[model samples]
Every structure is written in C-alpha cells, then in structure tokens.
Target chain A: MWKALLYKEWIKTRWYLLLALLVTLGFAGYALLKLHRAVALMGAGHIWEVMVTRQAVFIDQMQYVPLLAGLALAAVQYLPEMHRKCLKLTLHLPVPALATLGVMLAFGVAVLAVLFGLGIALLAAGARPVLAPELVGNILHAALPWYLAGVAGYLLGAWTILEPTWKRRILCLLMSVLLLRLFFLAPVPRAYGGFLAVLALLSLCAASLSWLSVVRFMAGRQD
Target chain B: MTRFAKLFFWFLVLVLLLWQLPWAVNYLLVQSRNTPFTLYSEVLDDFVMIRHTSDKEVEYRDRAGNEYTRRAFDSLLPLFYARQLTADGRFPDSVAGRPVTLREAQIASFIFRSAPKDLNRPAPGLHFLLESMSGRVDLAMPSDAFRLTGRGIEFIDMAANRIDTAKSGRFTRMLLRKGCRFPVRELSGNPSARKEYDEGYLLLDADGGLFHLKMMQGRPYVRAVELPEGLRLRHLFLTEFRSRRTLAFLTDESHRLHVLTMPGYGIRRVEGVTFDPERESMTIVGTLLDWTVCVDGASAERYYAVSADDFSLLDTLSYPLSERRIPGLSFTSSSDRYVKPRFR
Candidate 1:
C-alpha cells in the first residue's frame, strides 16, 4: 500500500521534481564557478580568508536552498493530490491517513535526498581540499549549531503553510527568522553553555511544530 | 495562536539575530564590555565568551567577555605592525644599527623620529619600536653602522653619517617575505623587522644595559649587556631623566649617574656603556627623558644629554615641555627594545 501511494505521489509530481532538481543543480554549478574564483584569490588553502570572503555567498545558498527545495517538493507532491478527486478515492481505500501521510513524507524525503546528493557531489568534486578529514571535522564540529538553525527554519516553514490562522502563521515565520538570526549574529557568552541550551530549545520547538502541522494536515484533510 | 504559527514566530527571531553574525559582534562590543565571542555558520550561529580579570587572566565567559578581548586585539596588531613598518620605512637602515660588512672598527650615525600607527589603549601605551634584519636596505649600509655581538645591534641614529665605509645618503629596497603557510606577496616600500624590539616584556638598559627576563616560552631569565661608552647604568625610573641620558637631576657624591661602557662590573658589549659612580646614601631613581642620551665625567650629577629633538641642549639636559617632570612625558618602545621618545 505504501509503495502504491508513493507511486501515485510520484506520478503526480515527477515533472516538477525533475525541473526543481535541474534548476538547483544548474544554480549549484554557477555558485561553484564563483567559489572557484574565490579559491584562486585565496591561494593554495587559506581557509580563513576564503571563508571570510565567501561568507555572504555561502550564507545565501544555505539560507534558501534546502528549505526551498523541501517546500517545492511538498507543493508538487501534496497540493495537487489534496485538491484532486483521486485523493478522495485514495483515502477511501484501506490505507490509513497515517500511512498515506507516511508515503507522502517518504516521497518528500526522496526529493530532499536527491538535492543533498547533488550538494555532496559538488563538495566532493570541487571542494576537494576543503573536503579533507580535518575540514570535514570542522563541518561536523559546526553541525550542531547549524542543525538547530535549520530545524528552526524547517518547522517554521511547515507550520506557516499548514496552520489555519494568517496572523499567527506570520508571527511564527517571523519568529523562525529571528531565531535563526539571533543564533547566528547575536554575540552569546561562551561559558555556562546558556546560549546553546536556548538554541536547542528553539530548534526543538521548530521541529515539533513542523511535525504537528504535518499530522494535522493528514488527519484533518482528505481533499 | 495556532501551534504552527508560534513555532514559526520563534524561528524568525532566531534567524534574524543569528544571520548577521559580524554585525551582532559589533553590536555587543558597542553595547557593553560584556559580550561573547561567536563564530557563525548556517548550522551554528553563536559561540563562547571571553573576559579579562583583575588578576590579569583572560577568562572565557559564555557569550560576551571573551569576544571583547579578542575583537579588540585582532584589529589592533596589524595597525601597530603597519605603523612600525611605515615609520621604520621612513628611516634608512643605517639609522638603526646596520651590520658591519667590513672587519675593521667603524662608526655610523644618522637621525630617526617616527610616530605610532594605531592604538589599543591610548597615546602612552601604544608606543612600539621595531628592527628588521632580512632587508638589504639595512644590510647595504656601513660595516659599523651598528656594532653587532651576541648582545644585540648598537650605535643607532645621530647627527652625521660617520661610518668609515659605505657612502652616505644611499638608499635601496628589499622584498620582505613573511613566511605564512599560504604565501602572499605584498609591496614593502620601507619595511623593517622590529617585532621583538617593541613588545613590553623586555627592558634593555642600565650602566650595563640589562633586559628583564620576565616573558619566555620555557625558562625565564633576565639578560644583561653592558652598553657603549658615554652612557650610564642607572635604575629604570626614566621619569626624572626624561630625554637626558646621564643623571643630572639628583646630587649624589658616591652614586654619580654618568653611564659609560668599559668592561664594567656588569657590562656586556660589542660596545656597551657602564655607570659605576656612586654618591653617598644614593640608589638611582627615574629614567631620563627617552629622547635624550647622556654621557658623564665623574659625579652622579654630571652628565650630558644626547637629544633626539632639534632643540640645542647637547651640553645640558632640559625638558622644555616637562619642565623637569617625569610622569607626564611618555616614551615609545620597539616591540622588544626601547626606542628614543620625544615630548608629547
């Protein structure tokens, strides 16, 4: 049943997914070209200078790409299905709302995995020097902080779309942006681990909200 | 009040503040002394804190204090290096004691005066002096521009170019290659290497010039060297003898303050100066004005000031601006060695 639902979802959204993937990879190529110029200016491997100089560019990509991909994937898969007459027929079958929601999520995840694969390929091919174990270690070291930021954005995006209220949804979206900015920009004291704790809490809140939005959408809507 | 809405709202606040990490650091420094030092990434936005304590220890506090110390120092060193490089550039290498290309004894003299580039604290503390070895400009000068031994270089700037060998007024340029892991080519018009010369840890002076051995990588010990002739070995209280090399301020029969370099009791030298004359009931006090170097005959009170300033006071020592005050006047130093200071 899950495989059948996934097949149905793919049938609805394959074209959009393909287009999103193509455009995304195309943009990645353009970005890598820019990064190559920056790398040349940075010499053999002046990591710090390269980082500082390309900070703005990396920031733009990180902020928009993943979640925008996720959103696009979601729209392609679910929005059309929910509004179609076939959605009601699919629901009337023995498949539970949970199972149907699961397949939709799995489809969403597949799209995400493809996008992430492209990013990894770019890193492996172009960022060879920076892709070393130590640099990878650095990226891992920063994983927790950026993970929290991403979760917050993800939840906020999911919630704003699924939530019924206009004003409250806007507020949540604004909160997500604010939380992301604060965690990145605001100078927090290093000791006592207070800042990290707060960021963890915000990240959890975003994730929880996203999960709640998805569950509510599945349970409450057939069309 | 939708559940989804609340979540999104908080995320917005977080991202807004976190994204502008550089600006946020600036804001923290401006807002208060307390702010954490943070490095930004999409995954991780904020970081640890740092602070300075009364005990002179740098402590990493969460989010605030650590950053102030780092941010303040990070922007400060380059300005200092640049200023020292630029000012030192203004000087011919011969002004600072250059190496003797010839084996024979020779004398070289020139004049040097420079101001600091940038400051961390204020006018007085920012003074730094520098010396460079790699440059051909300093090397191309006279053989005896400065008498070099294990002690250090000597016979710095003065009136006329008196080094026996090498023509005066000759200038040249050399490339200063700073060996970083990643190489960068920068144009150096007049660059001198003086990092070790300006840092405040070492004090190189006395009848026999002594450098305090407080700062070290492993073991710590004060290094002592005797200075050249026509100099004094006195206490390091430079306030009293601002600009004047020999002590003329106080009257002591046994503790006479004219320092000359002759294989003294504590003199170490390629050419070092010593001051052994003592007046009854006297321990030396106050450094002479930084600009003035003095030579003495016999008495503690009898010394001549070799002034760096243009005002004629070679036969005597006088602080035209200080009017014989010490604390108000400031002295500039190289990263390691003390350079001559002018009145404020």
Candidate 2:
C-alpha cells in the first residue's frame, strides 16, 4: 500500500523533479565554475585568503535556487490533486487519511533531501581540489541553512496549498513566511550552529500542518 | 493526528507572535540614542565631548558644562589634533612640560577598538603566519596557512591543497619544544601587509599557557610567555601598533584588562578597569601621556583615563543610556553572529 502511494506521487512529480534536479545542479555547477574561474585568474592562494579572512563562500548565487525548487515541487505535486479534487478520493482509499497524507509529505521530503544532498556533494567535491578542508567546511556550513530552508519551504508550501479555505491559506502563508525568516536571520557562516538541529526538527514537525489542511478539506471547509 | 496537528500549528503561531509583536512595537516607538563622542583630555583633566546640536552645529564641551570654540578645542586636545595644529602654524613646541614634535606625537598615537560581535563570531580555524624578518621592506603573506589539531599544528599549502609535512613538522617541533600544548584554545593575529610589521600570533594553549609564535626568514620563532600565578586569560588581542611599546591586550576570567608590554613581555594589570570582551565594546586612544579607554556597555558608556606608562587609573566618567526597549524573544543579537532563541 505504501509502495502504491509512493508510485502515485512519483508518477505525479517525476517530470517536475527532473527539471528541479537539472536546475539545482545547474546552479551548483555555475557556482563551482565561478570559483574555479577565480582560482584560474588569481591563484588559489588568493581564493583561500579571501575565504579565510573575508568569509567569502563563493556559492552565494545558489542560495535561493534550492528554495525555489522546493516551493515549485510542492505546487506541482499537490495543486493538481486539489484542482481535480483527487485528494478526496485519495483520502477515501483503504489507508487512513492521516497515513495517506503522511506518505505524500514523506515522499516530498525524501526527494528534496536527495536533490539538496546531491547539490551539496557536488559543491564539496568540486571545491576540494583547490581549497583546504577548513575552507570547504566553511562553504558547507554557510550553505547548510539555505538547504534547510528548502525542506521547510516544501513542507510549508504543501500546508498552504492543501489548505481548504482561501482566507486560511493566506494565514498559513504569513505564518510560514515568519517561520522561514528564522532560518535566514543571521548571515554569518556557521551562525546556526546547534540551533540548526532544532530548526530541522521544527521543519519536520511542520509536516503535521498539512494534515490540518487535509482534515479541514475532509470537513467540507471552503473559501 | 488531527489534534496533534492543531496543537503544533498553534505552537508555531505563538512563536511567531512572540517574535514579531515586540519587534514591531520596538520598531515603531523606539528612537535611536545619539550619544556624544567622549574622550578624556589630559590638558583639561576632564572628559571632553563632541556632539551635534539640534541647530545642526557641532558643539565641543568639557564635562563641567564649559563649551569651547573649535580652535580652542584643537588647542585643548593638542596630541589628538597635532597635524591640524601644525598645519595651522599654532603647534605647541612642548606638551605637558616635555619636548615634543609632530612626528613623535603621530608615531606615539594609536587607536584600538574591539567589539563583542568580533569576539563572539566564528573563527576560521586556519591562520596566516607572515614572515616577520624577511629583510624586505614590505611584508608579504605566506603561501601556506596553518591549523591547530588535536595532535599538533599542521600547515597546508594553499595552492596545492595538501599538507606540507616537512614544513609542518619543523614548526610543530619548535612549538612543542617551547612547551605549547596541543589544540590551542584561543589564538589572535594581525595578518595584513599594510601594517608596519608583523607580530604573528598569540596562542592560549590547552593548559592555560600563553605562547607567541611568529615566522622569521622562513623559520619559527616561538616563545613561551610566562603567566602570573592563577592568571587564567580568557581573551587576547595582538596589537601591532606603530610605537611597538605593547605586544597584546589580554582579559582574564575576572574581566580585568591586562597589557603585555614589549621588550620584556611583562604582564601588567590595568588598574580599576573591568572589560568583558564578550559583552561590551571598547575603544582606546593612546598617546605618550595617557590613554582614554571607553567601554560601551548596554546601559552606560564608561570612560577611564589611565597613565600610558603604568596603566594606572587617573579618572573616570560615565553616561547612562536611557533606552526604551521592549524585548521578548530574539533569534539574532547585535553582540553575536549566531541564530538561537533568546529571551531577555
């Protein structure tokens, strides 16, 4: 039953996921290309010095790419279900309604993890050649918060999209914006530190928010 | 599941309210404080202030409610405004009954500033050790950087992105021979070519020992600085000032400031001054006569006049800040570079 639900989500989001993968990887590659071009122009020593002294990450261009990918993925996966009123039927399946929504949210979260993980790996592998381990660690630490925001963006995007009433959807969006603002409050590298784990947990708890929308949808709430 | 979801949703709503409501109120109602720039004057024996008046004019005054003209102010702080006084042909031949010159005054003067945010931020573990005695007029940055590990120091060539084992071993041996424990707790250095010269780094080791490490002609110059008994230092600032009279400024666990003087590395406690480098911002204007040290705190800004020779407290002044703040929940702070839930 879980496999069937997973297959349904995959079939729905497969094409969009492909595009997201490419766009995210393309942005990551472009950032790496710029880093290497800097190294080629002014020796690797210059890059390392800047990264050390000035807190230059060299991947700031890709900061918002993951966020957009997550938001878009949520829309592609859930908007169609709502437009066609297929969520009603999906909830009426043999599985419990909460379990069904849980599977859907889990699928979105998993795919986002894979996508963001690949982007981070690509950055680290590309940066390892011309940078020391410390510099590479600095770059990764700076990017960690942005990637976490992508996960939160997907979950909150689903919560907003699955909300039954238009007025309530706006409220959910306002809350999400404030909550996401927490992820970007500090610009310094490694500023999140241990707070990142707390943020990740809160982001996962946001998965339950989509269930609230599903319950409202089942109760016949409307705009 | 529905009940849990509803509870979680309300929790998030409460968090946002606590975070945003106070911020919005403070933004709407709070006015920024315009504190005067205060400095202690040896000639006046009082704190002098420079402030902007409501009529869009600059006012210079002493703490005793005495205002002075701009030229009079320049004459009062002759050391601070020496260049201007010299250019105007009104420079004093001697100050404080000692023979002085514009060159001596300029070389003896330096400004040192440290903020809480600078000390509270994350440190990039790698450090550059420039050649201190390369026989060249201008110092150049080294091709490699070093990191302190659990075992010893490791130097990595930046271009090759690999460890230079031979060079690393040589420095590691010297540091070990100098009795520096592994994994430095805190290290400070000024690593720019624009400075007069390099003084390398001041390292606090695991055993609460202080060591001075620098590179001279591609070799290591490590000195184990002896600390006074039970003097556990919490922070260090390596000052490469033009006069070269002092090597670094240190703060101990009791928040008392200490100065490490040059030629002998003698650690002298600056009397009657307490500066917590983690919470307050401090600025010091030094001359051959005295230093005007300003410690800006959350509630008040305190000024101390200390003798440059012995760092003994001469006088003190303070101005209390009347800040109208509505603090509830804050994730970011002006004093730190971290994002964490803090309530004040």
Candidate 3:
C-alpha cells in the first residue's frame, strides 16, 4: 500500500523532481567553472586539485549539495497541500497510513540519494590516486545528519501550514529548533537513537496528516 | 507534540551534532599535555645550546619511561660563578680580597627535569645548562658563539628592566669570577663558527645582572659528559611586544615558539612599547638590531617593516629560504635565513 502511495506522490511531483535535477545540474556547471579557475590558480601540483575532476558525472554531482535543494522543493509544495486538506482525497483510499508515509519519505530520500551518488562518483574520479582512506568514513558519517535535516525541515514546514491552530504550529517550529540545538551539543555527529526518534516522528505526522486529508476530501465529496 | 513535530525536532539536533565532533577532539589533546607540565616562569635566553647524549653507556630514566636524549651548549666559554654575600663578603674557593669563583666551568646543561616524572613514561631529555646557585645567581655569558667561553653562575639582579638591557647600568653585585677572562676579541673565521658555538641562555637586569637560566654542565671544552640526574625542565612561555622591524624567531623548526620577552628572549605579558594617543601611530626605538616600527600602540604581529626614510624593507635577508611567516608570532627579530646571528 505504501508503495502505491509512494508512486502516487511521485506521479504528482515527478515534473518538479525533474526541475530539481536540472537546477542541480546548472549549479554544478557554475561550481565546475569555479573549480577550473581555482585549479588553474593552484597549478598542477596543488593539493586541492584533487577536488576538481573533469568527468561529466562528477560535474553533474556538484549540483547535489546534500539535501538543501530537496527540502526547498518539498517545503514549497508538499507541506501546503497536506496542511490545507488536499492530502485528504488521497489518504481516503485503501492505504495503510504508516506504509503510505514510509513510501513518501523513501521517495524523497531516494531522489536525494541519486543526487548524492552522482557527487560521490565525481569526487572518486577526481581523487584517482592519493585519496585519503578517512574520506569515505567522513562522507558516510556526514549523510546521516544531512538527510535528517532536509526531510525534517520539509515535513515541519508542511505540518505547520496544515495545522489549524497557530499554537501547534509555533510549538512545532520551536521543537524543531530546540532539537537542532541539542544535536549540535551532542558528542556524536551521527547518533542512531536521535535518527530513529526523528524518523518515527516524521512518519507519524505523515500518517496523521494523510488521515486528515482523506477525511476532509470525503466530507467534500458528500457535500 | 504530533508525529511531524517530533521528527522535525530530532532531525535538527542530529545535524548540529555532526558539526561539533571535531571541536571535542582538539580539546582532549591540549588537556593531556598539561598533565605533565605547568607554567612556572617566563624564561627565554639569547641562544639554546644542545648536545645529544643518546650514545652514552648509562642513561638516567625519569618516572615517565619516555627515552629522551640530552642537549647542551657547544660553547666552552668560562661562565662566571658568584657567591652569595655574607658579612665577610666571601664564599667558596676564593683568594683573599678577590671575588669568589663559586661557579665552575660548565660545558653542558639541562634546565627542565632531567629525571623522568614517572617510571612508566619515558621522557625525552633536553641538555640545556642549569644548576642550583647558593643564594648567588649563575650567568653563562659566552662572549661569542665560536669561543664558547663564559662566567658560570655569575649573579642575579632581581630588578631586571624589561626595557633597555644592551647599555651598561649598575646591576646588583654578585661575586663575578674575575680573572684573565678575555672579552672574546676574535670569532672563528669558520662560518657559523659562532652559530656552531652553542651559548647558554641568560636572564639579565637593566644593570647587566643575570639570573633565571639553563646551561650544560661540563669542562670548558669537553665533547660529552654524564647527563644530569632528574634536572627540572621549565615550560617555555610565549610573550608579546611591539617592534619596529622584524624580530628573529627561533631557528629550531623542530621546536615551537614558547615565549617572547621584551629586551630579552621571552615574551612576558608586559607591553614593550608605549604610544601617545594623539600621534595615532607608534615607533619602538632600538638599542640593538631592531628599529622602532610604526604601529598602533603595542602589538605582536607580522608586519612588512618599511624603512621610514626610504620605505625599503630593512631586514629581508634574514628570513630563511622557503620561510615567509612565523606561526603565532609573539616576538621576532632580524631573521637568520640569509645572515647568521652575529652573536651566534
């Protein structure tokens, strides 16, 4: 059921997804030009030259700066629809709320992953020989936090607009900010417990909002 | 809070935590080094003499099992040894009516603890010269680098002027081993004959009294000797002062800048130059190689020192090849990159 909902979300937003990709590619072009000039300035023997590669895929991945672009798109589109009752029409169908929410989140995450994969491929191509072994570990560690912030920010923005009461919206906003503060203070960059907690909450909200959207849609249909 | 709110909250925290991991690692490293070290005095001498003692048959171990080799001044210049003044004005081996020669001719020294603080931790030993003075201070003043001659444990003038030291003034009297000690008339034609001659460090008063130091212990010309047992190594501190032209930093790249003193080697917290608020500029007068620089009051930084008359760089030759700036520059002097220290 979640698969169907995930597909449904994709069908509605696929064009936006394409737009996001193009925007990323354009950003990559700009980054590539900058890298070329920087490399030229550093000359052939500069240590930072490894960061700039000529491979097409590598250039393409520069468009992907973790999840910043993804969240921006989602915030402008998904949150408003659910908060304003547009999601009700879809949730009324025979779908497990949790499954549907999971698919939607995965769909978002997968799109983000594609963006990231392209960048890693390019960076790998650039670092042909003298790649530091620790780079992989650091990049892996970095992804956890990037994904969390991107998805969480989008969801929060959507939920705030959907909620009827101003207090709940304010509370949600404050909570997100508070959580961000605590994370910075924590010892580990990637705390598994924290990730799980965030995932559970985001999934739960998606379910609740889907139900609300479905109920409102049905009421409109009867009228 | 609703499910969406919870997710948003947690995600925010995770992102912030990732940014903070690197900071924790740095703090841990500094704390560890502090365990075996503490700041005692702001000590800096003109030159640090070093001699390697690893080849010796018997090596002393500190409480820490760290294996450290010893170092000492290569110079064999006779050092002045002063005796504390009694009512009779005499101490140690002395001729009647003559100054007491309490200090012996020293060849090597270790200022810090020669002994390991712990048995398990093997510490590397530094062979800078220093020993106890019987109420009188010791001065290891080598006339020039090549000659390696000095007066050991000469005397201490407690009221040292942080301002002017090159000129002569009445320093408190401690018995100076007066003898046929020659003012080094000629340095070795051997290039860096002076540099190769490791001079002991000294703390001097405005009146030329000396105190607070480290020197190697040995005969005036001996090549090696037994490393001292459990010598106390003091932590060198970094100091700040204003300068007109560039001040030479430590030549030992293997070592870092630990202290900068005004008119001496270390930097005390004291500001070395003063300025009038109305002038809106500053200049430091030099009794030695440095010129008074134009600056904003007292500052310790790297500036392109231009000659006020011609605006040409005054001390460009002293920088070593491939060196541009000193890290955490506290005090600097004319460089040694091209020209070696005249005193060295």
Candidate 4:
C-alpha cells in the first residue's frame, strides 16, 4: 500500500522533480563556471583574498533558484490535486489518510534533499580545489540559509495549497510569508551560522502543518 | 496530532508577534534625538557647543552660556582653526601660557574614531602585514596576506597562490621566541596603503600577553609588550595617525581606555572614562595640548577633555539624550554582526 502511494506521488511529481534538478544544477554549474572565469582572470589567490577579506560568494546568482524550484514543485504537485479534487479520492485509499499525506510530503522532502544536496556537493567540490578550506566553507555556509528557505518554501506552499478553505488559505499564506522571511533576514554572509540548526528544524516541523490542512479537508472546512 | 497542530499554530503566532510587534511600534513612535555638536576649547577652558534652536537658529556658546561670534569661536579653538586663525592674523603666540606654533599644532593634531559596529562585525580571518620601513615615503599594501592559526602564522602569496612557508616560519619563530602563545586571541592593525605608515599588528596571545609585530626590511620585528600585572586587555585599535605620538588605542576588560605611546611602548590610562567598544562609539580629536574625547552612550553623549601629553582628565561634560522609542525584539543590531534574537 505504501509502495502504491509512493508510486502515486512519484507519478505526480516526477516530471517536475526532473525539471527542478536540471534548473538547480544549471544554476550551480553556472556559478562554478563563473568562479572559474574569475580565477582565470584574477588568479585563484586573488579570488581567495577577496573571499576572505570581502566575503564575496561567487554564487549569488544561485541564491533564489532553489527557492523558486521548491515553490514550483509545490505548485506543480498540489495545485492539480486540489483543483481536480483528486486529493479526496487519494484520501479514501486503503492506507490511513494522515499517513498518506505524510508519505506524499516525505517524498517531496526526500527529492528536494537529494537535489539540494547535489547542488551543495557540487559547490564544495568545485570551490575546494581552487580556494582554501576557509573560503570554501564560507561559500557553503553562505548558501545554507538560502537552500533552507527553498525547503521551507516548499513545505509552506504545500500547507497553503492543501488548506480546505479560501479564508484559512489566506491566513496560511500570510503565516508562510512571515515564516519564510526568517530564512532571508540575513544580509551578511554566515549570519545564520548558529541559527541554521533551529531554522532547519523549523522547516521540517513545517511538514506537520500540511496534516492540519488535510484534517481540515477531512472535517469539510470551508469559507 | 490535534494538540501538536494547535501548539504549532500558537508558536508561529508568538514568533510573528515577537519579531514584528515591537518593530512596528518603534517604527511608528520612535523619534531620534539630536545632541548639540560640542568640542572642548583649550583657550577658553570650556566646551564650545554649536546648538540648533527649536526655530533652527544656529548658536555657538561656551559651557557658561556665553554666546560667541563665529570669529570668536574660531579664536577659542585656535589649534582646531589654525588656517582660519592664521588668515585672520589672530593666531596667538601661546595658549594656556605655552608657546605653540601653527605648524606644531597641525603636526600634533589627529583624530581617532572607533565604533562598536566596526568591532562587533564579521571579520575575514586574513590580515595584510604592511612593511613598516619600506624605505618609501608612502605605505603600500603587501603582496601577500597572512592568517594566524593554532600553531603558527601562514602567509599566502597572491600571485603565486602558494604559502610562503619560509617567511611564515621566520615570523612564527620570532613570535614564539617572544613567548607568544600559539593561537592569538585578538589582533588589530591599519592595513591600508593610504595610511602614513604601518605599525603592523598588535596581537594579544592566548595567555593574554600583548605583542607588537611589524615587518621592517622584509623581516619580522617582534616586541613583547609588558602589560601591568592583572590588566586584562579586551580590545585594541591600531592608530597610525600623522601625529605618530601614539602607537595604538586600547580598551581593557574594565572598559578603561588607554593610549599606547610610541617609541617607548608604554601605556597610559585615560582616567575617568569608561568606553565599551562592544556597545558605544568613541571619537578623540586631539591637538598638542588636549584631546576632546566623545563617547556616545545609551542615555547620554559624554565628552571628556584630556591633556594630550599625559592623557590626564582635564574636564568632563555630559548631556542627557532622550531617544524615545518602543523597545522589542531584534535579530540584527548596528553594534553586532550576528543575527540572533535580541531585545532592546
């Protein structure tokens, strides 16, 4: 039953997941290629010095790509289910309704984790050879908050999309905006070091919020 | 599941309130206060203040409330207004019974400013050790940058993209020979090429010992500075001013500001002043005779006039500032680099 449910989610999100992976990887690769151009023009040492003294992360172009991908995934995966009322049929399957919802969210999170993880690994691998450990660590740390925002954006988008009524959906959207603002309040690089753990926990905790919308749907919540 | 969802919802609401409520109130209600620009006048032996009246009229007055004409105000602060005094032919032969020339005053004049925001912000773990005796009239940035590690200093050559292990070992050995502990606690230097000269860096070692390191003739010149027993230094500012009278300005754990005199390397405490480099901003405008030090505090802007020769407190004045605002939670502050929830 869980396999069937997993298959259903994969079927729903596979094309979108592939697109997300490509877009994210494209941005990550482009950032590295830009870094390579910089290294060639201004020596690797100049790049390292700038990163150390000025805190310049060459991958700023990739900052919002993960976030857009996450939001797009949620829109692609849940908007159709909500519009077509296919979620109601999926809820009536042999599996427990809440468990089904949990599995769907889990699958989305897993796919995002893999995609985001690949992006980060590529960044680290590309940066390590040409830069010192400290500079590489700085670039990675600077990107952590943005990627976390992507995951949170996806979870929060799911919550809003699954909400059973228009009035509550508006409230959910407002709350999500506030929550997502936490991940982007930093303008300084590595400003989110100590707070990253708590932010990631909160992003994962946001998964539970989707279940509330599901329960509201089951209770026939409406405007 | 219902209980958890309810709790989560309330938690979210609480976080929003904590982050936004005070911000909105402060944004709507806060009015920042402006204090009169005040400077100590050595000739008048009083503080000269340029104040803006409610009607927006500018008035210059001494602490005794005696109004002064713009020309008179310039005469009172002759050292600060040297060019104006010379041009007016009112340049005095002496101030406070001490004969001082315009050239002398100009050479002795210096301004040093340190703000908590600069100290508390993020710093890249790299430093340029400019050559102190480059044999050139003007200082220039070094070709390599250095980072202090647990064991020793590592210098990275910019063009070569490799560590200069030989030069690094030489400096590291010099520092170690001077009894500097492996990892330094804090280091300060004016590394810009625009400076008049380089004094390298003032480093506080792990064991709280202070050492001055500079490069002269492409070699390390390390000097172990003797701190007064039990004097725990907290912060340091390398002052490479034109005056060349002081090497650096420092604050200790007790928040007392000290001046590190040049050549001799002795420290003199600027008495009767407490400045926390983590919270307040301080500016010292100095002439040969006196230094007018202003420390901007939470509730007041305090001014201290100190004798430049000895750093003895000559006079002190403070004005109460009323900055009305709603206080609440903030994540980032003007005085710090980290983004963590804080209440003001």
Evaluated with TM-score, which candidate comes out highest?
Answer: 2
lDDT (0-100) at residue A98 of candidate 2? 87
C-alpha RMSD over true interface residues, each candidate: 18.3, 1.1, 21.8, 2.2
Predicted candidate 4 versus true structure: per-residue lDDT over B1-344, tens digit per residue: 76787788889888788779989988788866657888889888888999888898989999999998899899889999988999999999998899999999999998888888677766677778888897999877777889899999999786665789999999999999999997999999877777777889999999889899999999999999998777899998989888788999989999999989988999889988899999999999998899999999988999999999888899999998888766777777878777777877
Candidate closer to the true structure by TM-score (higher is better), 1 or 4: 4
DockQ of every predicted complex: 0.07, 0.86, 0.01, 0.47
For model 4, the stretches where C-alpha displacement exceeds 4 angstroms are A44-46, B84-93
DockQ of 3: 0.01
- lDDT, candidate 4, A1-223, per-residue tens: 9998889888888988888889899999999999989988987656765776667999989888888888898998899899999999999998898888889889888899999999999999987767766677778888888899999999999999999899999999999988888777765677776778988988998988998999999999877
Count of backbone collisions within predicted model 4: 0
lDDT of each: 0.35, 0.91, 0.33, 0.87
Model 4 chain B, poorest ten-residue lDDT window? B117-126
What CA RMSD would you report for each candidate?
21.6, 1.2, 25.1, 2.1
For this target, which candidate reaches the highest lDDT against the unseen true structure?
2
Report the C-alpha lDDT of model 2 over A1-223, residue by residue, as the tens digit: 9999999999999999999999999998999999999999999888888888888999999888888888998999999999999999999999999899999999999999999999999999999999988888888888888899999999999999999999999999999888988877766778888999999999999999999999899999997
Which number leads on DockQ?
Answer: 2
Model 1, which residues run further than 4 Å from truth? Answer: A38-63, A81-93, A129-156, A164-168, A175-211, A214-223, B1-344
Cα deviation of A29, candidate 3, in Å: 5.3
Error of 2 at B148 (Å): 0.6
Count of clashing residue pairs in every prediction: 115, 0, 91, 0
lDDT of 2 by residue, B1-344 (tens): 87888899989888888889999999999987778888778788778999988898999999988999999999888888899999999889888787789998998899999999898988788889999999999988889988999878899998888999998999999999999998889999998888989999999999989999999888999999999999999999999999999999999999999999999999999988999999999999998788999999888988999988899999999889999889878899989888899997
**Model 1, B48-131: lDDT tens per residue?**
224556676776432333334443343222211223434445212222232221111111121121112111111111111222
| B308-333: candidate 3 lDDT, tens digit per residue | 22323443111122322222211112
Candidates sorted on DockQ, descending:
2, 4, 1, 3
